[model samples]
Target: MSRVRIFGIGSSSGDDQAGWLTIDALLAAGLQCDDAMVIEKLDRPGANLIPLLDNTAWVILVDAMQGSGPAGRIQRFDQKDWPRYTKGLSTHGFGVIDALSLARELGRLPSRIDLYRIEIGSANPGEQAGDDIQAAAQQLARCIAADLIATLLQA
Candidate 1:
């Protein structure tokens, strides 16, 4: 099995900009089910992210966020520091951060996790996230993938 993994959750909100950009970035980077993944919602990102933790050493969650940043700004949240940065309302009932916090509170959280969020212009664009932000999200995706791959290769 591929060791590197990514779970991308974009909202059906924010004009869908973050969601589109995240999916585009993953596609542009050529990440796949075996090496990486781009998901639209965290609560239902399927079984892809959950099971991997059993055999993998790391997991990266990438998505879009509103408030406290400029467009195209990239943000990183470490597992330990996620709480301070992740308290807010998400269109997707309980966002990845919320779900994670729940898992952690219940003592079922992953041993290692990383979160990378790209500040988007907005989430709509119904069809796609436009050009510039899509590229930016893709950039974030590559960085996320590289980080995972690096960790695995090192081990």
Candidate 2:
């Protein structure tokens, strides 16, 4: 039934790899789930993201955000609370916020949407994530994996 779907969005650049790294960590942690769970990694999906949420009961999106803070800090926002936190904040003119707004308007937004934004130190191409960001990605992935399991059990 695809009860839970997680989409990690990022490019291959420096700290932008947070989303991909989190997905890698989840796999390394040996997250076990039934066919009801789906995980994907995307590189600036843009408008292609809308259709992916169709019929999913819950959606968790992990991405990197450039903000005034030490890298690797984690912040979570729900579908309804995001606009308040990221007004006009779009990376490359299009990003999660735009995608979510489109989905909401089209009535394709999932019943539950969780956005995990990881503070990135830099997004310079070819650069790797700093130590702190790497560590945080691993920790966040583990936490999300555990939550997915608990949610699945309740279903």
Compute each candidate's TM-score over C-alphas. 0.72, 0.92
What is candidate 1's lDDT per residue for 92-147, written digit by digit as tens? 54566766765666565556777777766665535556565666776776776686
Candidate that scores best on TM-score: 2
Top lDDT model: 2
Scored against the true structure, residue 37 in model 2 reaches a CA lDDT of 77
Q: What range of 10 consecutive residues in model 1 has the weakest lDDT sum?
A: 38-47
Cα deviation at 47, candidate 2, in Å, is: 1.0
Query: Model 2: how far is 30 from its true place, Å?
Result: 1.0
What are the C-alpha RMSDs, in order, of all predicted structures? 3.8, 1.7
Estimate the lDDT of model 1: 0.59
TM-score of candidate 1 relative to the true fold: 0.72
